[model samples]
Target chain A: MAEDHKMTYADPWMLPETKGFWEALNDGKLVIRTCNDCGRGHHFPRAMCPHCYSSNLEWKESDGTGTIYSFTAQQVKGGGKYVYAYVEIADRVRAITNIVDCDPDALQIGQKVKAAFRPSASGQNILVFTPA
Target chain B: MTAHDARLVGAYELPYRHAPDKSLAQMQAEAALGAVADAGLSLKDVDGFFCGGDTPGMGPMSLIEYLNITPRYVDSTETGGNSYVSHVARAARAIDAGLCDVALITLAGKPRTPAKGSRPMTDSNKPDQDFELTYHPTVPANYALAAQRHMYEYGTTSEQLAWIKVAASHHAQHNPHALLKDVVTVEDVVNSPMVASPLHRFDCCVITDGGGALILAKSEIAKRLNRPSVKILGTGEAVKHQGAGDIDLTWTAGKWAAEKAWKMSGCTPDQIQYASIYDSFTITVLLEIEDLGFCKPGHGGGFVAEGNLISGKGKLPFNTDGGGLCSNHPGNRGGMTKVIEAVRQLRGEAHPAVQVPDCALALAHGTGGSLGTRHGASTLILARED
Candidate 1:
């Protein structure tokens, strides 16, 4: 992705727990924690399985494709527009991301989308979504 | 053994709308004193304390030292806007267990005043901060996602959502303390500037500075307080997720909480005369009404559109104090206001213009956190003693 095309904002690359996820994004992969015990996947990576409370977890790469569970077009004061949405990934897990490369108003619920890495204001790669 | 055996003997709201001059502790003190007096008790009689707010920093200790009272039991459960209603259930449980006799639950904040550094209080270091904040989703935007999905799945319309604000404004016309007194039409709500898709500016809640307090006493102490006591029939609390994308957006924890409350209270949904639902957003009220069994899934939009939530015209009156949409929000969880209004309705003390006639049973429901990503729901049933 070109630097100019990237959305500028504070990135969470500094968080020790999520450093690996950010590193994966930089390597062109979208990853989440899949609990080994429960055999389920989750987002915003956690130390323990939220569903089963099992510390048995591993990092797994997602196919980076999902459906827009829901979304909103935020019209900024300076005439800028951004589409924010919750993308439902595997096993009903949802990830909050920005929808890019399309008109904000054109975004729809249940629309198919895939992840795209873009440079953040903090000079780190962050994951955003685009129409698949 | 049940909430029915306990009573909320006192209720008070600190000055609503604007209180820029007062510190958080000062507002809480005023509300706490007012509630203590309303219950015909003194500070010395308060044996338990429960409070939740972002301001004042130190949790129970700040209020405890500021108010200069020590209690044996303290609960500082800070679950978004549903904290106060959640406290009611916890307080009742403590009192019933004989761990504490007289308990005070309070909430206060000054979100409108920059001098107090209170701006829609939120923790900066929460686990979900990394992902959720990166998209720059405002509170309305988060909730708008749920609203959009509801429209797509259930064919709910923006006009239907507008009615929730319209009805709240209609009730606000009669509330002297309500911040927005001007009656608003459905057209006004829909025509308002869009904050996010599927939700207009009017569809969101107001930001203000205020505080509220409630005093709960054992039935014996409540009976001798020389004031009308509203019995806490039953209460329920639940959390579905901390951040979004796990659970079904169309359903809420209210489905489980309200059912638990009804079973414990021995009161059916049809028997509820009034409802004090948390109105952080118009869609919130709609989803809660459905989850609480007032109507079936996918029927909330039409149910609210039929004017069922209006003060007098509808069978189930809601947000009789103008609700958070038009009333005071104060940056705290809204459950306190809901409880206060339910008490007033059951006591026949609500403004005559908005009071439900012969209201015997009332339901106070609250939702906390982002409705799209994560949320908590609390339900409390209150009734008058015959």
Candidate 2:
């Protein structure tokens, strides 16, 4: 079903601050930046910690497991149905990802999910989630 | 002496239709000129400007240059539909501080009639592109996520959401300029094509090519104008989140922004005779009404389900111009139109069928960006002078 659509997903435009997160994704690892000063974690990487304005940040591998906070079964204008959702990867941190490998209509809140990496139409690895 | 004393003396809505021949600049110029004329002021009296749009080469400077006005103040706060409401508050503050005397806030766009060589409407630099775009979430899908969550948490039924559309369409029937005036029902909305789960096409706002303008002046200047004026009694603005996460889906920045506006206005929710709450989506109106203290949290769906928002029904009249749901939404600046409608209602100038009798105070509120993620909320309270 995923291959039916001829859509091409391009690699994200990397900024100087976000290079590390994309590089880690390429290495088959999910990483989140943790603030050294405030002991907080964030995603879609930023240069400085959103909490406490700390520039002292460190990268750490995540378990890549989260719970579905909310989701929508989206039927695009010409595209097929897909489940888009906000999955909480850590305390107070959520990542937007697609829920693949399951009936989109069957998705429920608080459902446990795990990361699954797949090659984009352009051959760049992208992260998706599936029922754990 | 308070900054909240600014007055809106002039309001204009450009002919709401698809005029491909009219450039955005031309539409903006017409609306600006019309508003100034409505206030019985010459163009030279304008010393401040505010605008927001996504069309190429659209900004405060471009408008300033096009109008050829040397203004003492300018603002281009782009927070989607809520931008213009924020401008109203900022304009009031500027006038109160003696930074400017007459402020012209305008919005124009041609989303429905794109030119032959126009650029793609979607821009790639949006913050959500980093993550949320990868999942193929359309505007309707983003709101559907909130509707879904609201249903899960508070048992908000799809039928309840549909009632909002029905009420909007009912109001549109009286508005000659509304794009969709035919009456709609819960069945009509439920049977409409599903854009995203829990949100049908009818649940979303109509896209059109139109513009609106508002002229806010110092109370003294407004009093001298030959036209009716609405006072900016109170205003509040807030932004909770910007991207796909971090904020609660069921709640919006309106909770905080409306709280401040209510405090500053010294007016309770029941005192608001007319409301022009932004309706970028049906769920948006429900969430805002709840956050603004019009009804209890988790009870918005039921409150609206009782037909309380329908014009001439004796309840709080909302979106009396038919709202974005049925009237028009040119890009993300529906907030400007909301202000225009509220002003019209307070002045006893609205379509007679939809006008609330003896309307003394009005509220105009808007939400920008996705409800599921980070977004901006703005609320403005306006009153008619005795």
Candidate 3:
């Protein structure tokens, strides 16, 4: 894994609005932004609902359960083999995350997965998925 | 006839794959001179200017100030690789509105050896960087995510996707300046190293230094000039995103752009003698081919298999100049080269080996930004008027 020489933050820079989500992740709890109006959910949490544009959004705790919507393990030239995937979390929120604790080649679509916090190469707690 | 119509009277592509000594401005000027002269016009004749973010100094003025001519109109729309193709539609609309007489659009890039600090891995201030950057959204990986979903939804196979690269290699053999001139087969592609799961190394486009220019003149100027008339029949551009989380990874926004183009030109896919679909990746062509209405949805894989896109062999010939997959795609923003090749095919100036015979109507398309994330797509339908 190569690092961009210019990155200022080894860990995520949390904004006031996103503080709750980041704090929850570090606390060994997972959460998603749920819309009160539409009863739908989204990831990369935002203040307003992406589906209905309603400001009545709340952070609901998730059990880290989801299905593998799609995935690709990229092998860069002279670089590490990385497994990136889209996990369709419960409540219809699709999350793009890395898969861990398993062989990269063994991943498949429609498989069950559960989110877990693991240390990345940069020595920061990161979200990843494993075969449930 | 309305005085607003425009004709592409000049087209020029620089003959270089790696020009480390030349700066972006130098390449732009060289290609600009070649295009303007090819149109039987001079720099003084250019009254409108257009460029993309690749322009170095200051917006479109990097070239505008360098050439020392103040155009009556200017447009600096940036859509990554698709910017140049979108500029074609913008220039035509500007000319139709009597905004300018000669619209000159130029593109030049040197991604093979970028200037230090010019290529940043991540924008520190981009709003979503904190969320999406962690997943390692490398260019091919982002697209591979889409390929995976397409395979799941439509059953698109790697072999079917390999045909696109096969088509580009088939045409690249005819191009003297193409970077990868050797022809490749489906077996060769699938057997190559896998850069991303489902997308082998052959599935990606080559990165090379390149620059190309196009001069669209008022119809009257085109008539007086000695160049063949390449009419701008119709053009359309659109941006597609995740649609508020209701995203379908298999589809692209190109469908909307193509609809607008087809409605404006009154030309269906069957009437198009030559097609220049952008080739950022193999799956890109499959999606665009289906989106452009050349085949039914989910049928592009079968439509392109079995040498169906080769010049003399297939009913629909595409990328006779090798496209981005084999030839030059300046700065990796390939939209400019798409239109350049379409003009070549329309003018009968393509290489003798791959030239489409009596190419009367041609379509050139481009997709830029990231296909997985938010991106832009453009479509242009051109004609060689009798």
TM-score of chain A of each: 0.89, 0.88, 0.82
Q: What level of docking quality does candidate 3 show?
A: medium
lDDT of 1 by residue, A38-132 (tens): 88888878888878989898888889998998888876665566788888877678888888887766677888999998887766888898899
**lDDT of model 1, residue A45:** 85
| Candidate 3: tens digits of C-alpha lDDT, residues B1-386 | 22128888888899998988998888998889999988999999999999999888778876898888899999999988889999988998888889999989998889887876665767766657777787767888888988998898888999999999999999999899999999999999999899878899899999999899999988888899998978887888999975544557787878989998988888899999999998888988899999999999899899999999999999889999999999988888889889989999999999999999889999999998877777899999999867
**lDDT of the structure predicted as candidate 2:** 0.83
Give model 1 RMSD, 1 decimal: 2.7
| DockQ of all models, two decimals each | 0.63, 0.58, 0.53
In the order shown, the candidates' Cα RMSDs to the true structure are 2.7, 2.3, 3.0
Worst 10 residues of 3 chain B by lDDT: B241-250
TM-score for predicted model 3 compared with the true structure: 0.95
Interface C-alpha RMSD after superposing true interface residues, each candidate, one decimal:
1.9, 2.2, 2.1
Off by over 4 Å in 2: A1-7, B1-3, B54-58, B116-128, B242-245
Candidate 3 yields a Cα-based lDDT of: 0.85
The 10 consecutive residues of candidate 2 chain B with the worst lDDT sum are B121-130
The per-residue C-alpha lDDT of model 2 at residue B102 equals 95
Clashing pairs in 3: none
In order, what fnat does every candidate score? Answer: 0.74, 0.61, 0.56
Query: Which of the numbered candidates is closest to the native, going by highest DockQ?
Result: 1
Cα lDDT of model 2 by residue, A7-68, tens digit: 34556655678778777777887788888998888876788888778899988788989899
